[model samples]
Target: MILPIVAYGHPILRTIAKDIAPDYPELNQLIADMWETMYYSNGVGLAAPQINRDIRIFVVDSKQIFENMEPGEKNEYPGDEGIREVFINAHIKTLNGDDWPYNEGCLSIPKIREDVYRPEEVTLEYVDENFESKVATFTGITARVILHEYDHIEGKLFIDHIKPLKRKLLKSKLDDISKGKVKVDYRMMFAK
Candidate 1:
């Protein structure tokens, strides 16, 4: 049940997603497919919009990043091991701490990685897979992953946080993605 990820320049990626109720059709199945698709694509997260569904839903499994780290490598972000969870109707309650630049990439925009500055910590109010509400704070790599997927629900992309000059230089590459010229291992649905 791996769904095709929507490619860059897709209108759905630009459109703000809508919130869904617990009664939304096939909720469990959809979330399951998302997880499958994410793992298949080697992504830490996948937003509903990325799958051509304009809804406030996304999944994250930062644990993979930590689990796959080199033997001698150390965790840069203190107290951040990793997490596997689902976010529904997520809303940022606060974004705190200093901004740090991290190399970021998206499943929608393959072969394009850029450094984007983002807050070190974020407090969010969201519902879990069961539709149970919860409020939590995240930091380090987990925070970055959450914020990145959050952007998808907000009709924004990581590239939007980069410098204009840098983004300009990537214009051709971006265009190639839109027209289905870029190559990716995972399945993707292009705008063109």
Candidate 2:
């Protein structure tokens, strides 16, 4: 099932998500549904909160980002090719390297894209879908997607990272999204 994504300004999006236990009911089904929802929305990443679930779970298949890149741009995002993973109960152990600005968008905030500065690499400790713990490092585009989705679980959005002036300019657009005035193909739940 592809759940309706909750739009910006929805209270659930602002609430910090909780870590789920191994016995969380229907965990496998929920992950599968999330993947379906993400692909249907043409999104590289989706957090549990985005799907109206306040839990520490996110799915990413950043390979789509690499596949659509121009031949000359392929090398620009090294180490991100064919990266796919499920992050649960994730903790960012380290955020290292210089800050780079990446054009970011969210399924919740339709029709809005902004350049958000983020670390180039991230070290994370997280559990897989099966609740098996693992520690890993990611860089380039893969890191960018991970960091973006991680923010959802932390009650933060990509727009929150932009300059105050830019964010101020987007206030009306953000309000439109909250009131369900934005156009989006996939289903979305709005605050209004």
Candidate 3:
């Protein structure tokens, strides 16, 4: 299920998503489709809003690039594990730290990477597909992805993280992209 990713300028991208109710029909199927679409697009994470839907849901699978390492081991962050995780009506109660900054990019704003400062760690609570409440703590790249996708549900863009100067410099390029006057080289911009 390769869903069409909504680009910038779409109004739905700015609206706060509604929470998924426990009895909502098609919830399960929607999650499945999102996973399929995310993998098909080669994204580490995908949000409902990215697909032009105003729903508070996103999928993330980092195992494709990261794998867990033992304590004191170098670069020990956990990988995607190829399991597509669904976060419905997620809430981040706390964000801790300020020293770490990571370069981030978004599918919606393809081919642009910027140094975005985010909490190095986060505490998140959300409901799973079966309507069960779950809480998890994440750090490093995983935390970065979580925060980025979470912003999507609230109608936020990665460009919003940039300073005024950079924004001005990128204005024309962004405009060209939004108007379909130019094609973004996503691979060159975001390849790890």
Candidate 4:
């Protein structure tokens, strides 16, 4: 099932998600539906908040993004080939390396893309879909995508990282998205 992604300004988007236990109801089903929803929306990553679930969970699949990048491209993203994974109850232990600017888009904030700067590498600790806890490090596009999703669980949006003037310029568009005025191919749930 492809769940309706909640648009920006929704209360759930700003709520700090809670951690789920291994026995959480319909965990597998929710994860499956999230993958379906993400693929349907052509998104590289999706968070639980985007789907109106206030849980600490997110999914990432960077294969498509990596496939489109050329080997000799100016922005060389390493170790991102065919990377796909699920993160639950994630915590960023450390954000290392220099800050790099990358154009980012979110399924919840459709048709809005912006250049957001993030650390080049991240050390994250989280549980996988099976509820097994693990600590891992990621870099390049993988890290970027993970960091973006991580922000969702923490009640933060990429727009918050942009300059105040740039955000002000996008106010109307953001408002339109909240009121279901934005046009997007995927299904969405607007704030009431």
Error (Å) of candidate 2 at residue 85 is 0.9
lDDT values for all models: 0.95, 0.93, 0.75, 0.92
TM for candidate 3 is 0.85
Q: Pick the candidate with the highest lDDT.
A: 1
Answer with 2 or 4, whichever has the higher lDDT: 2
Per-prediction TM-score, please?
A: 0.98, 0.98, 0.85, 0.97
Stretches > 4 Å off in candidate 3: 67-84, 184-192
Per-residue lDDT of 1-192 in model 3, one digit per residue for the tens? 566677666667788998878877887787887887777767889899888779889988865545454444434444423334778899998898674667887777767788888877888999887878999877777778888899999888878887899989988877766665556433112111
Q: Please provide, for model 4 over 96-162, each residue's C-alpha lDDT reduced to its tens digit, 9 standing for 90 to 100.
A: 9999999998988889999999999999999999889899999988899999999999999999999
lDDT of 4 at 89: 95
Rank by lDDT (best first): 1, 2, 4, 3
